[model samples]
Target: MGKTVKLYVHWVDTFNRWVGRFAMRLIFVMAAIMLYAIFSRLFLGRPVNWVMEMSQFLLVSYYLLGGAYSMQLDAHVRMDLFYGRLSAKKRAVTDAFTILFVIFYLGVLAWGGFSSTEYAWSYNQKNYTSWAPPMWPVKAIMTFGIILMLLQAISAFFKDVAIARGRPIA
Candidate 1:
């Protein structure tokens, strides 16, 4: 039998890593804006809409991008009572099953998210407010983030399978 590669999932991992790391830099930007907003509100007695809006946008990207990273590090919220107590072999089996479930879950999310992104892009969508920026770009990030999560799940599924079988993983 030929060795099969999950290319789509791999690409998802690559994309997720890139975007996740890139999003980290935005923290500084958000902090700077936050300081400014605080200063403006506390001293100047006024808050700028653009700063608030931009912060919201940056936060959206930060969280979406971090989703896959959290998955990569196994940091997502989960009930771990059974998972935490399992033996190595049992854990591997559970891991495989869990990853499989995530694959399907994230698969659907990516599908719908991508379609949503496409719909927004097709209409040349923009935020319905002053300083209207194109929204499709942000939507695109959402879809891409989900895709990366799905891909990481696939690779993890294979990893758990290999571990369960007492085989070395590549």
Candidate 2:
């Protein structure tokens, strides 16, 4: 049992590290986009056509993709003072409820976001600028990110259940 837990922990750690790397890369990608936009505006006669919106889209994508990584590491913000003192079963219950609440919220976000994205796509959405691209692709980020975040939350809640059952979370 210990060996199995250790193997799972090792795998989880590997996944955590991989996701961290990707998150960092996304950060750099956003920064590069901003710099390029600034350079284009400063050095060229034309400013970056859609850089601001593109950067924002990249950032949303990063947060959605990076959320699971944060959850895996137990790095997310939570008020855990009493939580640490709770019995394992109690802790599991709390964790489960918390995640269920999050799931509800994410479900709302996903539904609404999907509707907006669909509307945009169906209408051949465009930006306000001359280089306007279809806005649906950008809008889709909300749905994707929220869904992924909800999945990670569900996974973490189950992890707590496992822990309460005397099984290792990993």
Candidate 3:
């Protein structure tokens, strides 16, 4: 309800929205590239060597970047069998508790990812393919994505905690 908290929520939501929009648009690009690769290989009889690697990286980036946005929408999978039966306050409490585990898991992921990205950057690691794309960018994106997911989780946890306490989330 406070101005600061509201501002933060708006900021987070806005960032996720932008990311989601970019990712969605990138899907079209991915499709176009795939079509071109397929057509060129089949018709022109010359396979594009970089196409596979590029597509793989783009797919990874798409999912990683869209994770926080999906979380914001609560689009991630969950077992609805028992969860669906819970009261609102109880569900909120359960969600808050469940997120504790997620926080710990993402903490470890972010730490390891950051270290890996740093090593990649320092060594200038590259893929074994002829394209030999630098690995640091994707690794860095992984770390950044995990951080974004963590922030989204924290926001959700706060909202759930408020709901569990019967507070109106203004």
Candidate 4:
């Protein structure tokens, strides 16, 4: 691997690690919100209208933001029926090929997310709920997450190619 490729991989890995850890903390925030809702409804005789929707948004953000780090950790689920028996190099070769499909999927997702975010921002769109939060922030985060996942996918492809070529990127 060239110095540039190694640097790119390292930077992306580091950034995703930070973002993923941040996203992980959002789970606790979501839990707190839920608990607040429960306490308010039970003790104060009123339920928070935005609690469920806010929790859903947090959940979406959590998974989307954590996606690249999951990929970096090789923690994503896969069918291991035949894969488990493959040699390391063969697995690298197979991963190189399969990651193309993932790249394509993320590309489409990013495009759609960008478009949605643009529309939301242009129209000042808001969720059709009682709380009615503006939709642009979450949509922008979605686009960003998809793009990060795409970048990580490309980085993984590069590493896999290097591994398949018998020059694995450390």
Candidate 5:
């Protein structure tokens, strides 16, 4: 492999690993927020105004940002019936092809999301809610998240290619 490709793979892998670890905390934060909301509503006789909106934001952010991490860990759901039976080389080949499709899909989303995020930032768009939180952050997150996923996909592609060619990836 070229030095540039190896560098990219290393960098993307490192970034995804770090970010994925950080993202695990988001689940706890989301859970805490929900617990607070539940307690406040039941005991205090009023729901938290920002709970729903905050949860939506947290959930989306968690899913989008943590995608690369999930991919790295091979934690994403898949039909394992046939896949599990495949040999290492076959599995690598299959993964490479599927990752190509994922790259294309994420590329499209990232492209559109970038434009939308730019528009939101320029216009200072805000969600139409009682909280009226600015939407640009989430939009930016969506764009950036997809980009990260793409980078991680490239890293995975290289590893799979190595496996397919019977080469040591590391």
Candidate 6:
């Protein structure tokens, strides 16, 4: 790989790692909110109106934001039937080929997410709920996360190409 390609990979990997770690912390926040909701409803005899909605928001954030990191770690699910028996180089070749479909899928997803975010921001859209939180923030986050995942997928493709070429990126 060229120096620029290596640099791009390094930078994307580093940024995604940091973002993924940040996303991981959201789980704790979600848990805490759920616990508070449970406690308030049972002991205080008062159900928090926004707790469930907020928890769902946190979950969406966690899943979207952590996607790239999961990809980075190769933690995403795959069919292991024939894949498990392939040699490393063969696996890299397979990954490089398969990731093109993933890249295309993510590209479409990112486009839709960006459009949704723009609409939400422009129209000041709000959820049709009692709490009625603004939708732009979550939509923006979703778009950002999708873009990050797309970048990571590209990076993985590059790495896989290098591996298939017998010059693996370190």
Top lDDT prediction, candidate number: 6
lDDT of candidate 4 at residue 128, scale 0 to 100: 97
Checking candidate 4 for backbone clashes, the offending pairs are none
TM-score, prediction 6 = 0.97
lDDT of each: 0.78, 0.75, 0.85, 0.94, 0.89, 0.97
The clash count for each model shown is: 0, 0, 0, 0, 0, 0
Pick by lDDT: 2 or 4, better one: 4
Ranking by lDDT: 6, 4, 5, 3, 1, 2
Q: Estimate each model's TM-score.
A: 0.80, 0.78, 0.92, 0.97, 0.91, 0.97
Q: Candidate 5 residues 1-170, lDDT tens each?
A: 67888888888989998888887788889999999999999999888889888888888888888999898888888988899899999999999999999989989998999899999999999999898999999898878878989988989999999899898478
Candidate 1 residue 36 C-alpha distance from true site, Å: 3.3
- Per-residue error at 124 for model 6, in Å? 0.8
Write the residue-wise lDDT of candidate 4 on 10-124 in tens digits: 8888899999889889999999999999999999999889999999989999999999989999999999999999998999999999999999999999999989999999999
Q: Using alpha carbons, what is the TM-score of model 5?
A: 0.91
Q: Which candidate, 4 or 5, would have the higher lDDT against the true structure?
A: 4
Q: Judge candidate 4 at residue 23 and give its lDDT.
A: 89
lDDT of 1 at 35: 94
Tell how far residue 146 is off in model 5, in angstroms: 1.3
Candidate 3 lDDT over residue span 92-149, tens digit each: 9999999989988888999999999999999999999888999999898888888888
Predicted structure 4: lDDT: 0.94
User: Model 1: per-residue lDDT, tens digit, 1-170?
Assistant: 11464454456567767877888788888989999989998999997667877888788878877778777677788887778888887898988887777889898999899888888889888887787888888788878777767777877777677778887255
Better-scoring candidate (lDDT), 2 or 5 = 5
Could you give candidate 6's per-residue lDDT for residues 48-135 as a string of tens digits? 9999889999999999999999999999998899999999999999999999999999999999999999999999999999999999
Which ten-residue region of model 1 has the weakest summed lDDT?
A: 1-10
Q: Compute the lDDT for candidate 5.
A: 0.89
